[model samples]
Target: MTRRLVATGLVVGLLIVLLIRTGIEQANLNRFDRDMGVILTAMKDEIIRAEGGGVALDSFVTQLPGWQQQLETIPPPTNSGYRANLLQSVLQFTVEYGKMADTQPDQARTAEMVENLTQAIAGWDEQLRNGPGEAGHSH
Candidate 1:
């Protein structure tokens, strides 16, 4: 019957649209994950270098601006509160680093900051994997 055919066509059209939307979302998610991984890894590396003392600490001063920019520019999913929270942690670290980098904080103080940053990164990563819940803040 004509009515049956029309109904089937509408359902099929909607199913195709749904599939396309899901694919697009998955692609976006993949890109976000890749970008975040690169930026976060760079950040953690710099923090580790700073903790090592000497030239590595000095390098962080130069590298941090780029790291911050990368994080700022990365396109997080528009609807994700968890991504925003993770980014907030990164922002806090950058702000803290800016404050302390100026004074050239002592090694012990730098170490303390590094530890806090590492812990915050871990917490955020966990939140990202397990869904948003009470993320621990370092700053």
Candidate 2:
């Protein structure tokens, strides 16, 4: 009887620990989703507004550093595939942006930036399709 009681207590304790761990993970995922949403929305808005104007493009370029800083704050993914995809998207966009900056300065640069932005957005869409959970944790 004593052995059975001890076994039951051990099982109950492990169950409680599992439940607590799951809850904490869920909370972290929620926070990650919120942060990613905020950053992505801001980036989309800026890109849309910068589609034509030189001033807008300049402003958008100026904002890139801040966006990068925010992105860096995102926690490492629990899943390797998701993390790799996210990193790939970020790197591809950065390279495309650099290409735009190196090209001749004009509305042409703005157009290139817009095109690269579109590609980057598509990369993000692909990431969403390949993301880990039903809840779509972004960070």
Candidate 3:
């Protein structure tokens, strides 16, 4: 009877530990989702304002390293394909905006960049829906 009690206690303890770990992981994923949403909204707003020269694409680029650093600080599963997609979108926006600001200097290019960014975001969303891990993860 004592042996059975010990085994049951051990099983219960292990189950509790697993539950706690899962909860923490879920919380981290939630935080990642919230942060990504905020960043995407800001990007969309900037693209919209680019038509009036109100958006500073260079400024956005300059801030990206800091954002990337923040992402790196998050624990694993937080830096998944969604984060990669955000980085790609930001890079694409910067390059396209720079080109438009230089040669075209018009709303057409700004619109194109916005569409590209949107498509990139959508692609990333699809990837996440199809897989739970990072797209580049080898394991």
Candidate 4:
């Protein structure tokens, strides 16, 4: 029957579309994971390097806006989970560091800022390894 054939074709088409969408989403997630790993590790390294007294808060103040924009582009699921929280902390630290850089440009407060961001970055890295364990993971 033509009706039966049409129904099956519709179902097959829908399934293919679903598969394509899922594949695209998976690719996006993979890229996001890789980018975040690099970003977090770099941030932590900069923080750790602050001990040697060469980590310039002014450079961070300029650099963080781009990082913040990248963080904003991360999709949901993990975005709403611990990853989002950690990103918020990073953004907050960026703003605070910028403000602090305006006044004293000292190492003590910069080190403290780095410590806070280091903790957030560590938590984010752990969350990434664990995968998106939250409720809104799309198939």
lDDT of 3 by residue, 1-139 (tens): 9999999999999999999988987787677666655655665555445434435644444445555555454444543555555545555555655555466645434555556655665554554345436445421
lDDT value, residue 24 of candidate 4: 82
Regions of candidate 3 where Cα sits further than 4 Å from its true position:
51-110, 122-139
Ranking by TM-score: 1, 2, 4, 3
Off by more than 4 A, model 1: 103-109, 128-139
Pairs that clash in candidate 4: none
lDDT of 4 by residue, 1-120 (tens): 999999999999999999998888677767766777777777666666654554454455556677777767665435235545555655676566566666666643456666765676
lDDT of each: 0.70, 0.66, 0.56, 0.64
Which scores greater on TM-score, model 3 or model 4? Answer: 4
TM-score of each: 0.78, 0.73, 0.57, 0.66
Candidate 3, residue 126: how far the Cα is off, in Å:
6.7
Better of 1 and 2 by lDDT: 1
Task: Give the winner by TM-score.
Answer: 1
In model 4, which regions exceed 4 Å deviation? 53-66, 69-89, 107-113, 132-139
**CA error at residue 103 for candidate 2, angstroms:** 7.4
C-alpha lDDT of candidate 3 relative to the true structure: 0.56
Once all C-alphas are superposed, what RMSD does model 2 give against the true structure?
4.3
